[model samples]
Target: MGAPFEIGYVFSFLPKLLETLGVTLLIVAGSLLTGIVAGFLVALPRMYKIPVLRTLSGLYLSFFRGTPILIQLFLFYYGLPELLKPLGFDLSRAPVLFFVILAYGLHTGAYAAEMIRASVEAVDRGQVEAAYASGMTSYRAFSRIVLPQALAIAVPVFSNLVIALLKDTSLAFTLGVMEMTGKAQTLGTLTQHFFETYIALALIYLVISFTLEKVLLAAEQRLKRHEAREEKAGRSFKLRRKGSYRAVLADIDAGKGGRL
Candidate 1:
């Protein structure tokens, strides 16, 4: 006889699975945080090139993106310790959690770099040039004029990256880091109720992922709407502020004021 799939199974086991949920969420949070910081650093070189650093950063992105993440994970978890020992680094006390984060960070950072660079580039060149012409230093111009616009452009890309990172957290289980999938596998093995365990796990993942996607989409839409409204307000203000200039020009051309 097969095990029944019922609400009882979920309610009963869900509390017991808190440890697994904690680990899974930790991996996702750790990876995304580390990856974004790495990516932000990588983005600088391309956005404002220091020739050698830019080349090196580009190489970093290319190599990571070109390789499979699973291989990268295996190499970091299995192979790097061997390499690091000779370099006089001790990895003995390091948990598998760190490797999961390292693998995810390097893999995701490569993609984030490209997305960020594109965002920075998407900023209007004229705005940057105007800042420079106004005596703003390169750094000042970038901070004030470039980065804000770039962030707006990058938000959508980053939201998707967050979703990808959420899914990729499952890979940690392969490395003996007992996250959600790992826990579910353990349950299935114990009870032989493969279908029940797996379906529940799938639903959990679906719920979390769907929730994050909706949040990101909502935030992205709000940002875009805010940007659009700001632009409209800026235009309206510029027109109103320059009313005298237009009125004078109209007076010169028409010999008198008609209706503004």
Candidate 2:
């Protein structure tokens, strides 16, 4: 007969699993940092329609997005070493965690590039025009005006990506990394309690995902509040401009009448 479910095993394994949580988080954090920077670089070319760069960026998106992440991991782990052997540089000697970061970062960056492009494009053209009319340089205008709005739009999407990447880090176990999943697997095998171990693992992931969702939601609300203030300020400026225009018109009429 199969062993009955033991709730105790779940609790017992929790600490062991948590011990490796740092590795999992490191992989996620490293990958995300790389992804954000790479994604932005990829996005700029596509955003500005820089012919050759745009094409290359599109191809990058296609190749990364088209393939499964597992395949990408394999390619980075195995194929990369083989490719580099001809150059007298050995990739195998490097840490597996580094390749995990590379694979996931490339994967995340492709999707992030598109998200960034969409968010930037979503900013109102009038906002850009106003920035230019205010004598702001292109870089200054974009950084001050366009980027703020685009980031607010992109934050929710990026939050989702964070959760996805967190889950994807489980695949690192396949590369022999003793991350959360790897630790869980060892505990489960030793204890002959696969179900309980997995339940604990799932709970850990759920807690992290839920916490991130809440944090991101709060950030979104704050951005909305800031945007509301900007809108109110804009209306006040328009009203003051209208009042000034009316006063100028009254003064011009008074001068004309006196002359007549």
Candidate 3:
């Protein structure tokens, strides 16, 4: 039979679980960095519609997105070493954390590719044309105008992804990496207080998630403020142009009246 729940034990387990929080965060950070770079590269072929590369990118996305992350984790953690063994390279002795990050990163890249593609597509094409008309190169226009807008559109979604990644780090424990969840499992076993241990773990996750949300929300708001200022400036410029046109028309009427 399971031990009775003890509320006091929850508090006691908190510090022990917190000790491994950094490991969990490290997984998220490493995976996120890897995912962003891979995602952008993967997205490029699709965005430009390159022939063979586009097909390969599509397949990459399909396999990663269609499969469960757990399977991917196993594949990388176990299968990859064997695959590399035939090539005279060995990964059997590599750090477990490395495989964890790689698997998560690849999984994240698949999702991020879609996010990046959609975000970039959401930007107005007319702006790019306008930039072209102003003599800017395609690269310049994209970098200066399109990328900023796309980033603004992407940030909210990316924030959600980050939160998801943070939670997903729990799976890293399956490979015995001793992350937060792994630590909780050990604590629970040692103390025989599964309920309290888990409750403490849940609380830690909640607090971290909440803090991340708030910080990302503030960043989103800051980006929106920049957008707001640009819009205001645009409105003022239009008003000034309108006023100038009116003055020109009035002067033309005065000249015609004098001639009459």
Best candidate (score: lDDT)? 3
- State the lDDT of candidate 3 residue by residue for 23-75, as single tens digits: 99999999999999989999999999999999999999999989988889998
The Cα error of candidate 3 at residue 143, in Å, is 1.6
- Rank ordering of all candidates by TM-score, starting from the highest: 3, 2, 1
lDDT of 1 by residue, 1-260 (tens): 55666656765556556558888888888888788888988988887788999999989998898898888999899877888999999896689999889899878888888888877766667788899999999989988888777776677788788888878887778899889888987887787676777777877788888998788788777656756686677652211213346434532424434435
Off by over 4 Å in 3: 229-260
What is candidate 3's TM-score against the reference? 0.87
Tens-digit lDDT track of model 2 for 1-260: 22579899889888889999999999999999889888998999998899999999999999999998988998899988899899999887899998999999989999889889877876778888999999999999999998888788778888899999999999988989999999988987887899999999999999999999999989987866776686678752211112245334532425446331
| TM-score to native of every candidate shown | 0.80, 0.86, 0.87
In terms of lDDT, which candidate is stronger, 2 or 3? 3
Give the residue spans of candidate 2 off by over 4 A.
229-260
| lDDT for position 212 in model 3 | 96
Cα shift from native, residue 97, model 3 (Å): 0.6
Give lDDT for model 1: 0.78
